[model samples]
Target: MSIAEKLSQMGVTLPDAPAPAANYVPSVRSGDLLFVSGQVSSGADGLIKGRLGADMSVEDGAAAARACAISLLAQVRAACDGDIDRLDRVVKLTGFVNCTPEFGDMPAVVNGASDFLVEVLGEAGRHSRSAVGANLPFGVAVEIEGIFRLR
Candidate 1:
């Protein structure tokens, strides 16, 4: 099935690619690899912001991570000139979580994005990843960047 079809089946509608919050571009094409900048946690309800292990639960952080994943796909679509299917596979993902110094479950939270991508793209979505805790900008719960290889 097409990526759009898969997304629809999962009750997801990719939002328009978000404009950059700073001067940097949202994504860049370097040969066959597309490097997507970190996407912050935000969705229909607005920015999912908070400090994990302080106020937010692991589940909520994961949801925020999922929001970042959705945004990453939107950026990928934009990079592909509106054709996401041109994408070949996910190469890597670097996830950052806003959390207390004591909080550890970064991997579990980032799984939200990884799981979603695999659900949509199957084996192609599997990729190397790194999940780390940091004080993300705007206090957003999670931020994720990705590398994609295009056909």
Candidate 2:
């Protein structure tokens, strides 16, 4: 029924919000919009890591991308005072995939995050998205950022 319950139904667990790696805050809000910093799949116990379509398979990249999405949501929850249910709409998402020069499955990899959000929030998760291939992404295979319009 609620977003948190939906996550539980899907067996998705949100980790503690990771601290920013640089000068940026994890999430910032101005007016009714909340912008989350780019989140890379990192610093968990033992996540598989490497360049997508190079050292990793498509499935791995997808998984990493999904992880990044959850990190973004964790930041959102923290920013909105530990309640993801308060978000009314996920407005936009931009994802970056670190891949080999010839890799072209970037969209599929990013779908991991897009799909995860939809599963967690149902209709509220729908959003515009961009999935781009990059030379590198903070040394990880996937990075995702999100913008949410909250109630």
Candidate 3:
């Protein structure tokens, strides 16, 4: 099935690619690689913000991470000239979770994005990853960036 069909099967509708809040572009292509900028959790309900291990549960944080992944896909679609099918494979993902210093479930939280990608792209979604605790920008709960190989 096409990427759009897969997304539809998954009950996902890609939102408009968000404009950069800063001076940097949302995504850039170099050679066959596309580098997507970090995306924070901001869905239909607005930014998901809270410090994990303090006021947010792992499940909630994971949901925020998933939202960030959706945003990443939106950026990737835009980068591919509105054709996500042009994506060859997911190369890597760097996730940042806003949490207390004592929190140590970064990997699990990031798995939210990882799992969703694999679900949407199957084998093409498997990729190297890094999940770290951080005081993310705008005080968002989770932030994620991705690198993709373009067809």
Candidate 4:
């Protein structure tokens, strides 16, 4: 089934793509690949701000990161004219977490986004990933970017 249909089956309703904060496209299509811009934990309402392991728990950071993942998917569907079937599989995912000096839970925080992909795409979502701690993630708690191979 198409990804949009899959989303419907899963009862997932994508939000509108958030407006870009700077001079950059949200997603870029080159050949059969789409490179999604780094999406911070921001909603249509505003940015989800805080520092994981300091101002927030790992679960909170993970939830915020997953929200960003949803936003990323929204951008993908928007770019593809509301159809998500063009996606073949996820290629890679990179997540950056705003953290404290002693925070060693970057991977846990990024699991927020990682887990979402699997939930939505099943095996197609499996991909190499990198979760790094950052001083700040565009001033948000978490930020994630993804690469996908297109059908």
TM-score of each: 0.98, 0.93, 0.98, 0.91
lDDT of 2 by residue, 1-151 (tens): 9888888888878888988888988888989999999888764664436887678888888888889888988888888798988888899999999988899999999988998888888788999999999865357888888999988
Better TM-score candidate (3, 4): 3
Q: State each model's CA lDDT, in order.
A: 0.95, 0.85, 0.94, 0.85
The prediction achieving the highest lDDT against the true structure is 1
Candidate 3: worst-modelled 10 consecutive residues by lDDT = 42-51
Across 21-117, the per-residue lDDT of candidate 4 in tens digits comes to 7899888999988999988897656889999777899999999889878888888877787777777888998999998889999999888888988
TM-score of 2: 0.93
Query: For model 1, where is the 10-residue window of minimal lDDT?
Result: 79-88
Error of 1 at 129 (Å): 0.4
lDDT of each residue in 29-131, candidate 3, tens digit only: 9999999999999899888898899999999999999999999999999998899899889999999999999999999999999999999999999999999
Give the Å shift of residue 54 in candidate 2: 1.2
